[model samples]
Structures are given as C-alpha cells and as structure tokens.
Target chain A: MSKKLVEAMADLEEDAVLAEVKALKAQNVPALDIIAYLQEGMSIVGKRFEEKEYFLSELIMSAEIFNEASQLLGGGMGGAGSSKYGTFVMGTIYDDIHDIGKNIVTTVMSSNGFNVIDLGVDVPTAKYVEAIKQYKPKVIGISCLLTTAFDNIKECIQTLEKEGLRKDIKILIGGGPVDEATCKYVGADHVCKNAQETVEYSKKYMGV
Target chain B: MKTNKELYNERLTRIKKAIALEKPDKTPFAPMMDSFCARHMGYTLAQFCFDVELSNKIMIDSIKDLGEVDAASGTSSFAGGMGLIFMCRVKLPGRELPENALWQLDEQELMKPEDYDTIISKGWQAFSNEYVATRMNVDFELLGKTGAFAPIADQRMREAGYPVYGGGVVSLPVDYLSGGRTMAKFMMDIKRMPEKVTEVMDIIMKNNIETMKAGLKAAVDPIDVFIAMARGCPDFYSTKIWEKFVWRYLKEVTETCIEEGIAADFHIDANWERGLDYFKDFPKGTCVFETDGMTDIYKVKEKLGDIMCIKGDVQAGKLTLGTPEEVYNYSTRLIRDMGPGFILAGGCSIPPNAKVENVRAMVAAAAGK
Candidate 1:
C-alpha cells in the first residue's frame, strides 16, 4: 500500500496520492511510516527530474503533492526528526526578487530529508550571515536571477569571509544569469544550473 | 571590395539556403544584437533605449562595423519608451532599474482568477483594452515620439543593402496568463482549477491565431514569424501537462502560420531533450527550430536537421566573458557540426556585456574572413 502511494506521488496524481494516504492512515499506518512512503515517492520524483524524464513543473507539482500528503499525515513528517541529511541555508540575493528557482531548490532539498532554512527572496547579505551563524548549516545556497546581482554575490562572499564563516560552509549559487565565469567571480564553492545539481553538490560536500 | 548590394545578396542567399535545409556557401551569422549596440556606440544603455534618433544611429553604425551579416539587426528588448508612456509591467533602463539593466517584463498577477470569466465574456480585444486602461497608465502622445527612428532606421538599413527579417510574434495561452497574472498564479490555476485553465486556453488559442494573422499582414512577404516559446520548455511541466496545456496551443498556432503561408521559427529554451518529438509533428520543411543553448543544438541537428532549419546556440556566458580565441573555437565547432541549415546566433538574447571582439570572432568565422 505504501509502495503504491509512492507510485502515485511520483506519477503526480494528486488526488490518488491524497486518497491513498488517507486510506493507509485509516487502516492505522503510523504517521512515521506514511512519511517514509512520501519521502520514497519524492525520491523517485527527484531521480526522474535528474534523469530529464521530469522537469520543473513536475518537480514543483510533486513537492506540492508531498506537502499536501504530509499535512494530511500531520506533524512528524518534517523538521528535525524527519531530517536525516543536515540543514541548508537558502535564499535569492538582496537585489533579486525572483524566488521560483530558489523555492524549487529549497523544496527539492528538504524533500531529500535535508532541513532547508529558506530565507525567502531579496535576502540581504547581513541576513544570510545571521542565518549562517544561527543555523551553522553545512551548505548555503545563494540564488540570483539578475546579472546586476553578480557583484552582490561577491559582497556576500566577502562578508562571510570577513566574519570568518566562509571556510566552514559550502556555498552554491544558481540562476538564469549565473555561469562558470560568474560562479568563479562570486567566489562560491560551486555553481548549480538546476535543483538536482544543487542536491548532488550538497551531498558531495557533506560526503553523504 | 564588393559593393554593399553584392555583400547583401551573398548573406541573404546563405540565410535562404539554411532556411530551406540546403547547404549555404558557409554558415550564416545573425548575432542577437541587444543592448550591445548602445554600448558599442559609446552611449549608455539608457541613452540607447530612450533616445530614438541616437538608438537608430547606433544600430546603423554597429552593423556597418560588423561588416557583412545575413540580416540587419535590431535590439531584441522592447523599446524603453513603451514603459515610460504606458504604466507597463516591463522594467526599463533609466526607470525602475539601472540604466544598464535589460528591460524585463514583470510577471505579476495583474489579473485574478475571477477575471477569466470577464475575459471570456468581453473577448480579448475589449478585455485587453480594459485591462490595459486599468492596468497601465497610457500616454499615446508621448509613446508616439518613441519610434521616430524606426521607419528611418529600416530605410537606412535597406539603403545600406541590409534587409531586416520580419519580426515574428508567438502567443501561448499560458504565456498570456503568465504575463498578465504572473507565472506563479497561472501555474497554481493549472493545478487547482484545471477545467478553467482549459477553458481560458481555448479562448487564448483563437486570440493567438488572430494575432499571428495580423503579424503576417504586417510583415514583409515570405513572412516567417519567430515563435516566442519562452517559458514553454519541457522542464516547466510534466509531459502529460505540457501536451494538454502548451503543445495544443503551439500546434494550433503553427498550423495557422503554415496555412497563412508564414514560416515559423521558435526560440526554445531549457533542456528539452525528451521533448524533441514535438518538433516531429510539424510538417517537414514548414518550420525552423532555434534553441537557447540549454537544449543541445548538436542533438537537435542530429534529429531535425534534414526536416527543418536550425539556428542558434552559442553560450551567453562564453560570449560575455570568454576570450576571442575561445569564441572563435566554439563558433567553429558549431559550424562544423551544424553544417547547413544553421544560422549562428546567441542561444538567446546576447547579453548586453558581450565583448565586441567576441561578436566579431563569431561573425568572422561564419564569413570565413
């Protein structure tokens, strides 16, 4: 039944997944087990996305469906107990308001059992520093869609370096305007073109 | 040295052969000239966008310097004057954004879900007029001054033996909603109220056909409309969802273009390796496919080269930051790989900051100079 539920979520059949989760719970499946099933489904979705069988909208849909199922299953599915992979600090940079790319990275990362602290859009350098200090996460993701934010990324890296936080965390940058040249210029540890690459990079840094 | 007319004829023949899926003397080059022209002429991008006379002059000068190319180019970005006259959602230079930043269309939900019924009832024109009146602040008199250079620019290019290709417009149902109500809202609509999405899409399909028809009339003979397939990539949706929402409208639009004797070229972005099958449905020799470097142009050539014209895709990053040697090497590989049926252009809008030397290297390689 749980495996079937995973298939439903992976296939992006929203109602079927919802109905299956409810049915499993009605039969007295533990919330924890249901969460596991949901995670398994999301894993498949991520794999499909990485393999190019799925795209952004499908990924977003799967995330949406997961959130819906999790809400139905209740509290234990997210946050500390659910997170096995360490936390990540993520945000679009100060001047850039685009968040779709950031949101997808956050959602995909969190679904993989990484506790992602999304700082929302237009996040200032100081806010990122504060989050890094608070979360002390192993990975930090900076998303910027505009070319103007190229220098701002450098400033963010400089600020982290000044505060002696640069060496501790792995920073990955992604967006429309970012490429290998800009990635080098911004001084990030890595550059990701998509959410799947971000996950792989995060895992690689953590040696997970 | 050859006369300008001789140069123009040579370039035009190259483009024509590529479009017809035949080998040209060499690969044709049409760099996606954007804000680069403004900067090339020692003017700030702001001066280029706002000053009509100066903008046109800079365009003429840039082409003259680039020497021979297949087509006379224009800035792909919409004129900044539109933003000034109308309360447009587009961010323009010297306005809400820095003078150097490219003009960007804001994807805000200016229309709510409730507006769907209103749009369906009133029709696109009436709805659009009302939407524009309520949504944008319009000053037609000021807007008229924005294009004092357009006619003169066209004439000057022709006199210089450069013929501008007709500007093509494409409209996807979801894109119309994305522009008006923002992508986020429209995406939510697709999930939450799918039936309504389809209903609205049907209306948009008819409206888009009308738009393409009008474009054919407005364009030069042998009209080819460059389909703006922005935000309609395979990455954005599941295959099931894309077939339902996007492909249907796209197919209908292409059919209209073909029936009207207008050829279609698309500006496809994102990694759409699995979605190449969609191109197969278009009749052979009826269309051209252009990619934005996200989808591998090599793979595209391998698959569709015999059937349709293929243009594009040098990486924007390489153009902007790489050395001329690097640009030359990459351009050579693309030419060698794509052979005939290829027009060398940036994968998308050439970034405003691309070095002139890099641009020259691309053109020079294609020209065999």
Candidate 2:
C-alpha cells in the first residue's frame, strides 16, 4: 500500500495520492512511514526530471500532490510532516519579476523534506540578508532572469559578504542569463540550471 | 575598399552564397533588427513601435549610420497593435508595463481544454476570429494595423535595394496553440492526451500550409520566407515529446514550402542541441537555419553543417553589455568556424538596448573591417 502511494505521487495523480493517504491513515499506518513513501516518490520525480523524461510542469504537479497528501496525513495525526533536510532561503533578485524557476526550486526543495522559505520575486539584497539572519537557512539561492539584473546579483553577494553571512551558508544562483561566467562574476558558489539540479545539490550540501 | 552599393552587393552575394551552402569570399552579416531603430534615433520604443511611418523612416535613415548590410531592420509588430496587444493580454515594454522593461507575452491559457473541439472543427481562421472576439475582446483593426506595418518595411527595404527576408510568419499548430493554451497547460495537455494534441496539430498544419501558399503567390521569385520557429525549440520538452508534437508539424510545414519551390528560412530560437539530430531530415539547399545564440553554433556546424545552411552565435547579452572588441572577436570566431554557409547575426533579435558601437562593430567585423 505504501509502495502504491509512492507510485501515485510519482505519476503526479493528485487525487489518487490524496485517496491513498486517506486510506493509509484509516488503516493506522504511521505518519512518518507515509512521509517516507512520499519522499521516495519525490526522488523518482527528481530522477525523471533530471533524465529529461519529466519537465517543470510535472515536477510542480508532483510537489502539489505531495503537499496534498502530507496535509491529509498531518491532519489525521494532529501534526505536520517534519523536514530533516534543513532550511533554504530562495528568491528572484531585485528588478526581476520572473519567479517560475524560483518557485519550482522551492517546491522541489520542500518536497525533498527541506524547509524552503521562498522570499518571492524582486527581492532586495537587504531582505535576503535579513532572511538569512532570521531563518539561518543552510542554503541561499538568488535567481535573475534578466541581463540587467546581473549587477544586482553581484551586489547581493557583496552585501552577504559585508554582513559576514557569506561564510555561514552556501549560495546558489540560477536563471536564463546566468551561466558559468555570471556565476563566477556574481561570486555564487554554484550555478543551478533547473530545480532538479538544485535539489540534488541541496541534498549533497545537507549530506543526506 | 568598395562603395556603399558595391559593398551592399558584395555582402548580399556573400549572404546568398552562404544560404546556398556555397563558399563565399566573406561571411555575410544580417543583424536581427528589433528595437535598434528607435534607439538609434534617440526615440523611445513606444514611439518606434506605435508610429509605423516614423519607424520606417528611421530604419531607412539609420542604415547610413548602421553601415553596409545585406538587409534592413524588423521586429514583431507589438507597437502597431497595442489595442490587440492589451486585449490579447500580451505584455509590452514601456506601455502595459514599465518604460525600460522588455515586452513579453503572458503565458496564460487564454483558451481551455474544451476549446480544442471547436478549433479542430471550426478551422483556424474562424477560431482565430473567435479567439480575437472572446480572448482579445477587440475587432481586427489593431491586428490589421500591426500587420500593415510589415509591408511598408518590406517595400521600403526592397526599394532601397536592401531586401528584407519576410521571416515567414507561420506558426505550426503546436506553436500556435502554445500561445492560446499557454506553454505549461499545453505541455500538460500533451502528456494527458497525445492523440487529441496530434488531431489539433493536423488542423493547424493545414491552415499553416494554406498561409504559406498564399505568401508564396504574393511574393516575387527567389521566394525566401523566414519561418518563425522562435518558441519551437526542444528545450521546453523532451526529445521524444518534441518529435511527437513539434517535429512532425515542422516537417510538414517545411515540406509544403519545399514542394512549392520556396526557400523556407527558419528563425529557430533557444538552444536546440538535443534535437539537432532532426535537422538532418530537412532537405538540403532549401533552408537557412538561423539560430538565437543560445545553441553552440560551432557544435551544430560539426554535426549538421553539410546538411543545411546555418547562421548566428552572437548573444544579446554580449551585444547589450560586452565591449566592441568582444563583439568583433565573437563575429570573427563565427566566420572562422562556420564561414561558407554562415550569415553573421545574433542568436536572436539584437535587443533594443544594444550599444550602437557594438552593433557597428558586428557589421564591421563581418566585412573584415
């Protein structure tokens, strides 16, 4: 039954996942066990996404289904599923309103049992520094889709360094304009092409 | 060491030879003129886009400053059709959004799943009119104005002896539906019902073929139309998905043009390395594969250079931000690597914000200046 639940999540069948979670709860399966099954499904989704078999839409849909299942299971057990993969703070930097990529990274991160705080688009550098102080996340990701925002990304890294927050957390940058050159220019530790790669890097960072 | 006319013909010959996959003395340069005209005259994009006559005048006048080139400038008529743009919910720079912001199309599913049956049966034009009425909520006046600008630019460019390639504005069904269904929803639809998607694609292709035939009849001989495949790259979907949904329709469109003896030049946007294997299928000497610099043009040359003509590799980022020397170096590198069939151009439209000197540098480098 747990394996079937994983399959449902992997298939991105939101309704099927909800029904399976409900059945498992009714049958007295441990909430932790259900959460484990969902994570396994997420791993499969990640693999498919990395392999180019699945795309951004499928990755997002799978995350939504997992969210629904987690909520259903949590409601029955009187608590939410706990994330052991640590925390992440991510956002699209200032002057750039694009967020589809950032949102996908957030979903993938959260689905992989990482607590993600999505700061949203057009985020100021100061807000990032503040979020870092407040959340103390293990990872900080900044996204910029526009060529104009390249300088702002560099400014963000400089701000982090000035605040002495650069040493504590790993910084990641991603977007259409961001390549290896931009990554190096902005002084980011890593450049992620997509959400799947971001999740993989986060897993390795968290050493899980 | 040539007069403007002599230089112009020299460049045209180089471009023509390259398109035919024959070796030329030098690589030809055809810069993708997007917003460069307005900026050249120190006018806002809003001014350039809305005033067709003014934009045309600026393009004609600016060619002297823009230097010797095979063709003049052009962009999608977003300005000429502001009413339709707003009605269609398409975003624009300095108008519906910010002054300096780039114009963009909002990828919302303006059409729903049930609309598929209507499109399949009602046909493309009827459904297009319906879409304008329902989705755009406006009459065809603005859209007509937008289209009207194309001829003025085309006529003026030809009269000036710098013939513009009418990037044949036909979208494959999947590409067309991508706008209506939005990319994400359409992708989902493809996954959910491949058969239904294929059915609609057949309708779209038939409509597109008719459009192509009409265009061929309207234009003079040496009929080359730039196929706007900007959103048709393999990056958005898997290779298999691209084959199933995009390639079949694209092949049909290409075949229709080839059978009619028209040159089908393709303006393919985005990185299409994953699907470069499919380019081998296109009939040789009949098409020019114009790229937006995201794909490795050199890699493509190594893979499919012998099969079809290829042009591009200058990036918008480099043009907008990089120095003139960088532009010169990149242009020279493209010429050195893929010279014979190469037409020097941006991998995509030269962004409106491109520096004048940089634009000049690209043209100069192409001319071996």
Give per-residue lDDT, candidate 2, residue B354. 74
> Candidate 1's residue-wise lDDT over B161-206, tens digit each?
6656555566677667766666555666788788887887798778
lDDT of 2 by residue, A98-156 (tens): 65668778877776667778898879998999999998988888988776678789999
Per-residue alpha-carbon lDDT of model 1 for A1-208, expressed as tens digits? Answer: 4789999988888889999989999999988788778887888887877777877777777777777788886653243246768889999997577767888898789767688888988799999999999889999999987655677889999999999999989999998767888888889988898887888888888888
Model 2, B55-100: lDDT tens digits are 6777766665676667653533445343232223455555565665
**Cα lDDT, model 2, residue B139:** 26
User: Candidate 2 chain A, which ten residues in sequence have the lowest lDDT sum?
Assistant: A73-82
Error of 2 at B127 (Å): 2.5
Candidate 2's TM-score reads: 0.86
Clashes of 1: 4
Q: Whose lDDT is greatest here? A: 1
Candidate 1 Cα outliers beyond 4 Å, as residue runs? A1-55, A62-82, A94-97, A121-123, A146-149, B1-6, B75-88, B136-149, B221-223
Backbone clashes, each candidate: 4, 4
Candidate 2 error regions (>4 Å) = A12-18, A25-36, A51-81, A93-113, A118-134, A151-167, A184-189, A194-197, A204-208, B1-12, B73-88, B137-142, B220-223
